[model samples]
Target: MFRTHSFVLLALMALLVLTQCTSAPDRSTKDPAEAVDVADQELSLTEEKSAGDWLQEADAAANEVEQHSALIRAANAFQNEHQWQQAAAILSQLAPKKITHHSQKYYRLAKARWAAEQKVWAKVIEELEDVATQFNQREFRVLSLQLLSQAAYQQQDYWQSLVWQVDAQRFAEQRNTDTVWSIARRIKQSELPQQRPNDLALAGWWRLVDYHHQAMTHPDSLTSFLNQWQQSFPNHDAATLVDIWLEPPLKPSESELEAEQAPPEPTLAVLLPLSGRYKQQGQAVRDGVIARTGEMKNLRVVFIDSEASDIESQQKQISELSPVGIIGPLLKDKVAAWSAQPITGIPQVYLNQIDDEAAQNSLTNVFFALSPESEAQQAAQKINQQFPSSKSALVITADGSSGRRMVDAFTSSWENEQAEQPTISYFSEREDMKTTVERSLGLTDSQQRIRAVKIAAGKIIVDEQERSRRDISAIYLPGNLQQTRLLKPFIDVSVSPFAEPIPVYASSATHELRNRLGDSDLNGIIFSDVPWLIESSGKNILLSQWLELRNGWGLSLARLTAMGYDSVSLIQRLEMMNRMPGLVWSGLSGELHIDNSVVQRKLIWATFSKGEITLAKEADNAGSRYR
Candidate 1:
């Protein structure tokens, strides 16, 4: 029995060797027989070798064809084990010309994958550009198209991304139609080609996105437009995604229709910290709510102290109140705690936002906050509108999480409209502000050059010492009032007198009405803030009372008060706004609108002039005004 088993094993081993020898040679090799012989010899000798061992063999191979085969085998071994770095290293050593034609396709694919991992998007595109169309395997074709699409999207070539994504949907087994639609949505309507592409799929995607945008503002026209679109692209891949794309409204049942028609309950439940360290803030919010609802005769307001007990107890109190809609929880931790739980079917408008995105999936909740990130984003848009000629910007921010969020938001918004990435700098301490500003504006580099020239000449020969960079057309200062006050003057003096004056923009954090004297240094700095505080045209009796008592409540608390007023005003309109995302409400906070269950505000634009705040005429006339 032992002799028979031995003979069977030896016979199987011989068959494996024969199979390896008879395998087809790489297409890249001119001499197919020689390449196959070399591969067969290497396979027989290195049957138990690791990827590392194969790499060493490739480096010490007798000739170029042997080395190419060894390197491709090493890369495949490393990639199978998910050793990305090792695979990338092995792929880098391969010479494309020495590789077999069959192996050359895989070599390009491996190199493109490595580039994608490194986020070298341009390199990914370059590596795959020629071979993408030549791939015969469905998996390879699908992967190539998907990688190219992602690389183009990362490079902000939206049109190319959409084209590639549309092409990918054709070959993929389970088509990601959502990904195709999402890439299409990123493109602006005005940027779409007036003449559709000859590719039917690409043209269909363009028209669908265009029709969706128009349907948002004029929803009644969607059905007719969709019918026309289907007739034009009846055989297109996008036709399969029509139901998901339209997101048609569900028909209401008898009870649901009656509930919608019935009047909402008059009681409104509010959660606030009436007795904790934040009692003063709670009181200010309460005052604002009262000020807004004072004249409403049929309304009953219920105030629950959120800090008095745990979140569970607070929720119990909210249940007992059974109010029409709810608002408050004037702290972040409280808001986050509330968000962690399931919705109770009652509508809520949170005074603060939480970090958990999944918690905000419900349509019954609204996140409304005076977010620094929101202010920074609007500041970017305002700057773009105010200075249409400016292509680049310099952003200086404080060093912390808040600063990071502000800078990220500003960069994303700025890049959407401009071709260049804004230059960014950060300062950790108040004393570092001046140096940070100087370095950001290139004054430090300018001075270093002057000193270099003076040292070379053996005397102070240069008349001019420093000059700000001419490339920066605008500056964004996302700092607090005191920080802005300290940094503005340094920026003012750092620029060379010969250069054009760069316009500076700021967030609401830099705006305050309490100190006109301190604001003198902030002259010519533009900022966005809630209209209730910045503009006098919409002043009410409640706002007047707060202005009279400003000394007691402080400016920060006044902003919170305005938030509370808007929360009450939004209770009845939240559903309507959610349904019609294009609708805007002129509230005390700003031009309020709903976006993905969050209240987005377009604030009033203002600039400092003669030590006093004034409405920017350019903002009012240059299409920045919401109305």
Candidate 2:
């Protein structure tokens, strides 16, 4: 009986051990199928939950772990859908301490992305500055670094931004070498430290930027400079970039060197409507081109009548000539048509600007226009500079397409600079101008108040009216010469004697040298115009030629002549200007520069004083006036 009882006890002990093993098996030795089942269950839980379902789950979660997980999922889902506000709301509910250890990094990244969307750079830096280094995924790591770089750039910490961009390029699938180079360029040479940084990558990048700056003026030394740089930074990440900068040295024979020194003269094709409605304007441009190339033996000029019946025949002729560059299609429609069918190798300079989105992206096509809009933008900048303390402005433009464009440009530029929108008024006729000016200055309201007081007294009273609104600090007038002549007087008279004199600014359309005697009405108004029209100190080499042209073909046509001259001057320098930002070419049309394939002109500022135009005192002080 005792032996049987002992055997029964051993059997019971074995059964107990088998039950325990089945209930909780060792995880390391668990069956692969069972482990996969558990993982599938967790994934199914996540996949089943929608953003709304996740939010609901978060609210109903019984523990901190479940709540945090649910909230993170909800925020991420909303973020993926670009529902930023909803994502922000979801993230705001998450407690930092309650977030799961694995989800903490992702939560911070989501929050930072939301901040970036809101343009809150400080918040982005605050959230990502510490957590960015923890990301193990290449994509997440790269994104974090890029966000940090962009945030730093927005905050004007360019050095830090450069550091972040370089780090990103190291880890990213595709290197952002151009972006790194561009950011490095923004750091001024003067701002660079006297002592090189200890970071080899950063120091190498700085040296590269310095090399590029030196190469802009002295390209011949680039190969030698690049070789020296590579030797200095042999193991640096930018060592590979040296290959891009290095050009093969030309070992030419004496004859080859001579041939290179004096290469074949380039032929330039000029297309203009020489015999149609724009005959006079086209002739002026042709004459201007001839005048500019009269002394040049290295260039050949050819003219094509753009308005001729056989346009395709003209194109064939253009191809046959094999001109190095083509400049023309002055009419907007012609420019658009020419831009549609671009010549693959030859560069084109359009005389008029087009709004076609595709044309703006063409590498070989340049849009150069004597744009009144450009003048309006400069006028806005000039006003802001001259009147830094002025908070508000009034834009008085004529009621036309040109005037509307001027108003739009000025308003856009003014708001960008001041962070405040200016008031705008439009006029159609002479009476409209008077009424618009009076109403804009609050003179009409003042007169009404005076009449109201007289009516209240029920008798005629000689009571002076209150001053015009004092809020307006400046006036922008964008109009033609006739409109300006009619509008300036009304503005001068409408202001109450008690008010401070509001300075008036005008666009180039308002200025004409021949009409200077009539500009007595335009006195005290500062306007932007080309150097050819405003400069008479014999500084502009083309000023004499411009005067001669103006005497023969009116001021209106002479301006086109100046455009033609500038177009020719820019042809050879376009490539250089495109590659080098902030490079200025002193041209007769204006201070010419290129940005994104568009040649922009920075006009000189001049003010009418006693019916004569003189460079604005501010412009003269800044040395922008013709010397």
Score each candidate by Cα lDDT: 0.74, 0.72
Residue-by-residue lDDT tens digits, candidate 1, 1-627: 226675455334333332332243542334633464355323321246666566666656555676677766766665555556666655654556667666666678778887888888888888887888877767778888889989988876777788778888888889876688667756644456677678877888888767755654444576777788888888776787664545665787888778676656679999999997999999888988988889566899989898789888878877866687899787998888887783477888999888788876776788888887898898777776666664688899889998999999998788434346788999999999899989998888988888888888885567665888988878998888888888888888998898898888888778765652235667898887788877763355566678677665566787889888888877766654554344566777888877677888889878887777788776443321111
Worst 10-residue lDDT window, candidate 2:
32-41
Identify the runs in model 1 with alpha carbons over 4 angstroms from their true place. Answer: 1-265, 387-391, 416-419, 455-462, 516-518, 537-541, 617-627
- Tens-digit per-residue lDDT, 1-627, candidate 2: 226665455334333332332234331332222222211114221245566666666555544555566667777766766666667766765567655556777788889999999988878888888888888777778888999999888865676788788888878887766788667755544445556678787889878766655554444465677788988988876666577546454577988677675555678999999997988888878877887888566788989999984557767888877788898978888888788886667878899998886678755678998877888888777766666654778898878887788888887778334435788998877778888989998988988898788888886666776568787778988877787778888888888786778898887777765664336767898877777777873355565656665575566676788888888777766654554344566787888767678998988877788967788787333421111
Best by lDDT: 1
